[model samples]
Structure formats: C-alpha cells, structure tokens
Target: MDLELRHLRMICAIAEAGSVSKAASALGLAQPALTTQLQRIERAVGGALFLRDSRGTRATPLGDLVLARARLVLPAVDGLQDEVTALVGADRIGQYRIGATNGPVAAGLVQRLSATRPASPVTVHATWSADEICARVLAERLDYALVGACDPSLPAGADGLVWQPVCVDPVWVLVGERHPLAGRAEAALAEFAGEQWASAPGDGCFTACFATACARAGFTPRPPLEMDVGGCIDLVAAGNAVVLCQGTVRAMPGVVPVALTGSPLRWRHLLGWRPGGPAAAAAGELHGLAVQAYLDVVAQRPRYADWLGTNPGFGAQPVTAAAVSRR
Candidate 1:
C-alpha cells in the first residue's frame, strides 16, 4: 500500500495524542479501524513505530525517525496548499478567528487589528487553557491562539504548527493593599500556604500546574473561591482572599502584586498557528503588536519591569523604548 498524506498525518496525531483511542476520536475514526490502519502502516514501514503501555503510547526508535521526517513533509504540503488557495481565492484570508487564555495581549491584538484593518472582521474566543485552544486551532475552529505555558515546553500535538515565543510572564501573588505582605518586595510561596486562593473555575491544565507548584512549596493552596481573573482581583482587593496573577497585570485598586522571593512561578506566552496559514504569514506583525502591549504594561510597573530587564534571554524578548514604536 502506498502511504499517503492522510497516513502521515494520522501517525503524527497518534504520536501527539499518546494513545490510539484518543487519536482516533480526534480524527473521527473508530478505535478498531485506527488500530488496523496503524498495523498496516507498521508493516509498510518494516518496523513498529510506537510501543503501547499502561502509561500511554510512546514512540519507538523507529517511530522517532519516522516522525522527524513527517514533521518536515507535513508543513511542506500545508505550505503548498496555502499558496494555492491564496492564488485562487482570498475570501477566507482576511478574517482572523483567534483565541487566547486570559491576558492583555489578546485584547491588544484585536484592538490593533481593528484599527489597522478596519474592514477585516476579528473574532476572539476565551478558554481557560492553552491546550484546549491549541486543539481548536488544529481543528480549524481558530486561525490562531495566544497561549500561556508555565512549563516552557511545547505540548504534544504541535508537530506542524508555527509557535512564536513572545515573552515569559512572571506569575505574581495578589494580595490586598492593606495586607501585611503587600508592602514587601517579595514573599515566599510557602508563606501563603494558610491563605485561601481565589481562582477561576475550569478544568484547564493550569489548575494542575498550580497545584503541583504549590505542592513543591510544601502545601496545596486551600480550596479557592471560583471566579474569573477580574473577580479574583475584586476579592483580593476587598481583603477577602488572595490569588495568583500575571506580572504584567495592571494596577488594580486596593490590590498589589508582590513577587515571590525565589520567583519560582512563570508562564511562557506563545503565538500558535498552522504553518503557511494567514496567521503564520502575519506572525511578525502579531509579535510586534504583542511586544508593544507588553512594553506598555512593563512601563507601568517599575519593579517587575526592572526584574524583566535584568533577566534578559530568560524568555522575555528584549524591547527598548524605541522598539516599542513602529519603524
């Protein structure tokens, strides 16, 4: 049997999903059919590609070799399709369907696009997690996503996507302005073990990451009050509870963002989209818009801004006062 583009894409999906069943569901195929197809592909390739385990499917040595080539081939095919589609028709090229986790950049991107391309329609969606946003983008529900990743590593299933690193946003501790630690330069994560945290309700991966980070600091954050980031700020401001927030967050009344002594918390901001798509084609413009927005935020908070500047190359892109403006 001649292995085709569909076969290659399926292999990549399986590798990323880490399970045949999950990959099959994502591809809208039955698990048994996917299993049979996987077997055939293995036979054609002359070796087993993945090893099944209780943990999940992991790529074998042969599988890794195959995937490396598949990544290159898949994007080349996508580029060809994008070019051809653009040449024949431009109807779907202008509209931007974008999503983002809670951040200032998403609003900035939408506003900037509206100001620049007044005729082009921009749709923005909000999800609690980047993984879900990435899934929607892969499904073509979103043209691109501004995602946050605390781990700094790309999640699985991003084989053919273009990811541009924007910055590393430090996660700050939010407390009432009247709180004891509010006036301090920094505090330790363990010091807040007894305090209640206000968090947004969601099954997003951030919940797990947050829990793990707190666990490492010697305690799990107590049961948090369910609320959006804005609501979290309100609660924190009223001296009701504390919450974690991004460093670039604006100055909310009655609340103050204090850094942790070790500064152990951070999340990488990334722009993710399919290669050769409209979003990928406009990656530089998107990055510049995000950088400008971030710089504006940094300027307002001198403390974190100084910390950000000193930690150059630590994931936050270097931007000068001049670079913040268009050339």
Candidate 2:
C-alpha cells in the first residue's frame, strides 16, 4: 500500500470538497467505494488525514502537510505530461501558452498575439494564484506568465525565472454610484474608515499591504469579505461594501473606481518566463505587447487615464536591462 499521485489527488479533492460524499461525486466514484479507498490511504499514511463531523470534513495537521506537497507535485507532473505530448506532436510546438491571474492584460495580450500571428495558436490560462502561474511557467507547462503583485515583493515560486516589470498601478477603490464619495475624482483612505470592505481573493501580499495602508490611515480595517471578482462587483452595486481594485479596472454600470489620495498602496505588473524556453526568443516582443496591452486597458478607463496623468508614478514603467533579472 504505497502512496501514489492518485492517492494524493484524492486527498486534495476530499479536502477541497470538505466531505467524502461530495468528493466521491466530483471524482465520479461511489460514496462507499471512496470511503474504503480513503480508509486504505489512511492506513498507508498511518494516520487519520481528515476529521469528519456533522458540519463537514476538515483536514488534520497531517492532512495539511500532505496537501502542501500534492499541490507542488501535481503541477510539475501535469507539466511534464504536457511537454512530452507536445514533443510527440511537433506541429503544436509553435503554440503560445500564456498563464496569468485575473486582469485585463492577459486578454489584451492574447488579442494582440492572435492579430500579429494569425497562424500561431494562443491560449490563456487564468488563475487566482500568481505562484501557481509562475510554477506552471517553471514546469514548462506555460511559455510565459503575466501577473500582478504588491509593491516591493516578487511573485512566489520565481526561483529560476526571469522577471521584467510591465507597469506600476495604483490601487483604487470601487464604490456604488449612489455612494457619497463616488462622484469624487479621488478619495482619502480614512474616508472609508467606517465602511465595510470587500475584495477578490488572490495569493499575493495585497492583503497585508492593504491592512498596513489602512493602519497608517489611523484606523484598523475589518477582515474584508473575500470573494471572486464578480461577487465583489455585486457587493459594490448593492451598496453593501466597497472594493479595492486595480486602477485599470473596466468601467461598470453602477460602480465607480476612485483613486486613493497619495496612492498609499501600489501594485506591480510583471512578465516572467524561463530563460531558455520558447518564450525566450520573443521575450522582448512579448514584453512590448504586454505593455501595450496594459496601456490599451488604461485608455479604456478614462477616469484612470486622467488620474495617471496627475500621478506620474502610476503607469507603465520603462523597461531596461536593470529591470530584467532572474529572481
């Protein structure tokens, strides 16, 4: 009874679904069969990986350790399979696989790439984890990754990758049209001290960076409601909470994106890839396309473009040899 990749995947699915029955359904197996398999896995590992109760299932400490390793292993293994398959089918070698977290840049890049190279296939993989995107690039599953992180910090899992700065964007607030400050071009952070906050979930330093910014504004912020981008927009439209978003956030019907006075928090967009991978040959061209895409997104957001003119520090950064380095 040796632990295998399937076993690790089962463990992760159970933890994610929070119940064996749900996990079994998701994995297309009988509930009892899944339970038996879980029992065998527990025996092999010599411990109970999960604690089941009336509410739901939660991972034990041992389960946590197993899950961490599974996350790393699964991507690398999947990437290896992809690379092997691509090698067998040399015709697919010219395709561009772009990975990114939520933002307008990836979409813009894909559009530009398709227009410029009509014969080359372009695909975009979107995730909430910048580290996962970088991991996929390192594993050769993706040719390049365009991700954003808080200022002064690089994306995690970038040990052997080259990173180039695409732009520096100021974090802005999203408020409903009816909100008192919605009409203002800029609002101070302290103005929202008494309001509730919401934001999309991501694996980055933005959470800590936001908290520190709020603390400096002379008030402690409540734990923000973490949800997807759509959900965050819903909360703002309903006037239940305000959200923090990139300055280049698209215009919404009932919501407004307002810059924070003095730009207390900043986000840095980066383009990363393996040094000698397929993307290396066109790294300069790819980076230029990415920067242009960012500018295009900014252009669509008239208010943000206007704000950028007043704030020189918050737009595309100049790319130089100094800006491109291995992390």
TM-scores for candidates 1 onward, in order: 0.66, 0.76
Residue 122, candidate 2: alpha-carbon lDDT: 90
Model 1, stretches more than 4 Å misplaced?
A: 1-90, 155-160, 202-204, 318-327
Q: How many angstroms is residue 60 displaced in model 2 relative to the true structure, after the best TM-score fit?
A: 3.4
Q: State which candidate has the highest lDDT.
A: 2
Q: Kindly provide the TM-score of model 1 when superposed on the true structure, using C-alpha atoms.
A: 0.66
Model 2 misplaced stretches (Cα beyond 4 Å): 1-92
Candidate 2: 10-residue stretch with minimal lDDT: 318-327
lDDT of 2 by residue, 253-274 (tens): 8999888999899898899888
lDDT of 1: 0.74
What value of lDDT does candidate 2 attain over all alpha carbons?
Answer: 0.82
What is the C-alpha lDDT profile of model 1 across 1-327, one tens digit per residue? 456666688899999999999998786555654776688689889999999988999999999999999999999988886676556445667888888887657787777878888897889888764555776677566788787766465533344567776787778888999998999878888889889899864323455667778999999788777767788888898999999888777786899988876667777677778766677677677777777766666777787778777666543564333221100
Clashes of 1: 0
